[model samples]
Target: GESVGLHLPTLSVQEGDNSIINCAYSNSASDYFIWYKQESGKGPQFIIDIRSNMDKRQGQRVTVLLNKTVKHLSLQIAATQPGDSAVYFCAENIAGRGGADGLTFGKGTHLIIQP
Candidate 1:
């Protein structure tokens, strides 16, 4: 289920700088987590993901880290660019709950890029 917040938390970063987004989940039974990037007027796009069995995974310009003990997840974007400005969301999937379509999302965090 999509969890919406009254106000979206925000992070500001300079263009070309690295940006780190953090998220925390409460379900210990969740075995998979994914980070998504959603530009205005569009749905979330896949950024990176990490499984419970793995602590970290890297994509083109993104990295996802998982801390099972804390039920925390984070996404690191290297060399942030203007196009990176968007709302980022973290979703958790409980084991056997479903596949990608069954993810439960957190209130998105808005990433603001400063030129």
Candidate 2:
């Protein structure tokens, strides 16, 4: 079961623990990646992004890594805080699909911060 009714995977970590969220994209042609964090009633907010040409990119306390060999993408957050509690999603921009805005999103993971 995927954590109750939402059918979303859940990841629980200590309030100050480092957190990593992973996603696997289907299209091998995907060239760009973006990680988003969505809180309880709000829209997904951009966290960080990485291009397929690069293996890793860092922003502030977040790091995004792209593995083209396995079509894998991951977002790592250092010293997670209570504000980090939310649903995290990864979106991919397939090459030559819909110009600049074509993004396919993966099933989100619900990140829960434990006290």
Candidate 3:
């Protein structure tokens, strides 16, 4: 089962810093993974994705590192900013006879920023 409960939902940060959000997953058979960022009352935006065959993947200012051995994934922000304050979620998509499908999202981590 996935973790879902009344957990703290805000993270405070300075204008320029690094932020790391964490999520715990339930299913292990899931292979495809994606990290998404969602602002206040907005839809989730795709940041990056990684497959089971890959260990690490990088984007413009973000990097996604996957640890298949422990079924854990992390997203690293180069320089955190005010706009970077948002909720991040790690989704797992299991590929099987059905082909590619929708993602099962883990509980998100809220990122807050301070001036």
Candidate 4:
């Protein structure tokens, strides 16, 4: 089984700082990945995504780096702020067309904002 739980329950950071969250997936065959941000009770919002072929992808204030060699993944947030405080999730999907429902998500890292 994969590590569904986050190692850190909460991370506190000052405004205008940068934050990094980590996650590990279980399936070796999973080729698709997505990162989502959930603010409290809201649903997860798509942040960015990368395929197995790619090692790195980026978006506004956010970046996702994948390491197929170790099955490890990380998310980097630049210029973290109070609005950026939210629970982040990493999800993996099996590479293929049949697996449309392919989404196994890790627990989540809660980003706390300190004013």
lDDT of each: 0.84, 0.82, 0.75, 0.83
Per-candidate clashes, comma-separated? 0, 0, 0, 0
lDDT of 2 by residue, 24-99 (tens): 7767777888888999999989998888889999999999988889777888999999999999988888665543
lDDT of 3: 0.75
Candidate 3 backbone collisions, by pair: none
* Candidates ranked by TM-score: 4, 1, 2, 3
Runs with alpha carbons beyond 4 Å of true place in candidate 2: 1-8, 96-100
**Better-scoring candidate (TM-score), 3 or 4:** 4
**Who is ahead in TM-score, 1 or 3?**
1
lDDT of 1 by residue, 1-115 (tens): 3232213389999999998888888777888888889999998898877789899999998999888887778889999999999999998888766458688888889999999
RMSD of 2: 4.5
lDDT score of residue 2 within candidate 1 = 28
**Model 4 alpha-carbon drift over 4 Å, by segment:** 3-5, 97-100
